[model samples]
Target: MTVRETAATSSSNYLTRAGRGRGGQGQAFRNCNVLFHILFTLKGVREVASGQLRVLQISEKGLRASSRRKDIPDQFYMCIGDRQIHIGCVIVSRKRGLLDIRFLNELPTPFVGAVAALEDPFALLEEIRPAVFGLDGFVN
Candidate 1:
């Protein structure tokens, strides 16, 4: 597969199979704009135990909000302490408490700098208030 196709697959894979498509349906809601709306809405809200919000589960309804609409790419955003950190590739290994995020070729330079500064992944949710409503608010 071409880099673009591979990236597309990797990104959209976050959502359930039903959510993968251009037509209006599934978790993606068949509208990329709607995805961003949800993302921003999420960001606008606040939470009490904001730590859970750190590990962004990239999917149609998750971090791919911007890319899904622009037809760019998909990724997971690790929000830590008021910072929305993007991750191109992530391996959720709960046992290790490590969300191994692999950066894609198209990632921005500024985002690279941000991920580099991350010292601990476990304390991310609390450190990075990625969601507007925060973790507690989102889950509740």
Candidate 2:
């Protein structure tokens, strides 16, 4: 896994899987673009306690988010930016209250922009909102 994670030693297959495919010499979606304060929701079989999560940063393929609940399921569904659509995610790493996620599919460019375009919900205080672990498979 370590070798696969390293760009130098990573195979072409690994690169493709990572969305860093042919002709794109640099890793695709490696850069974290959205640094704005964004809050999104997480739903894991009613694991939500108002299931609000804070977005630390997000990229086209993944995101770093923080949650109030300690027990976030390894897989869950979440909204992208202000969009109502649910996207699947799988936890890649967890530490303290932070969750590092990989989207099941590469997000549309527009969706990524919407998250970056959003204003800080907490600072605004009165403000606004937003997986791939298909909720359809989960029981209530």
Candidate 3:
């Protein structure tokens, strides 16, 4: 039998798949299990669509989020309740207000940990600081 090395581990350090990322090809990942204050702006666009959103799911590869902001282009920079953490993303699918996006790079473990450690990720839902357009270009 081939041994598979999974990411999430138990207290004994044995490999396990529970609570780990699921980004397999053609896998239909469940969405909207968690909610945290998230911010993002349309990539390549001069902030035409920048607003607060709720992170439905987060993984090493990307995110499943819900946003009311309209006209979201194909790409954007997502901020996990912070202005400094700009994660470049590309839209994979959109329906209603749900946005399935893939990150340009694998998310660092520490960053994801920080998100999971938040006392209340959705405490402040009214603000997205530095509240201005930062990403460059436009989606044509």
Of the candidates shown, which would achieve the greatest lDDT relative to the real structure? Answer: 3
lDDT of each: 0.31, 0.51, 0.52
Give the Cα RMSD of candidate 2: 9.6
* Model 1 Cα lDDT, one tens digit per residue, 10-78: 655553222333222242212111111112213323522211223332332222222222211223333
Residue 44 error, candidate 1, Å = 19
Model 3, CA-based lDDT = 0.52
For all predicted structures, in order, the TM-scores are 0.23, 0.51, 0.53
The candidate that achieves the highest TM-score relative to the unseen native structure: 3
lDDT of 2 at 54: 67
Model 1 TM-score on a 0 to 1 scale: 0.23
Residues 1-140, candidate 3, lDDT per residue (tens digit)? 22333221332221112113334365333333444434444544455546656776766676778876676655556654345446666666678778777766666544444444545556333243322322232111
Better of 2 and 3 by lDDT: 3
Q: How many backbone clashes does candidate 1 have?
A: 14
Q: In candidate 3, which residue ranges exceed 4 Å CA deviation?
A: 1-48, 117-119, 123-140
Query: Model 3: which ten-residue window has the lowest total lDDT?
Result: 10-19
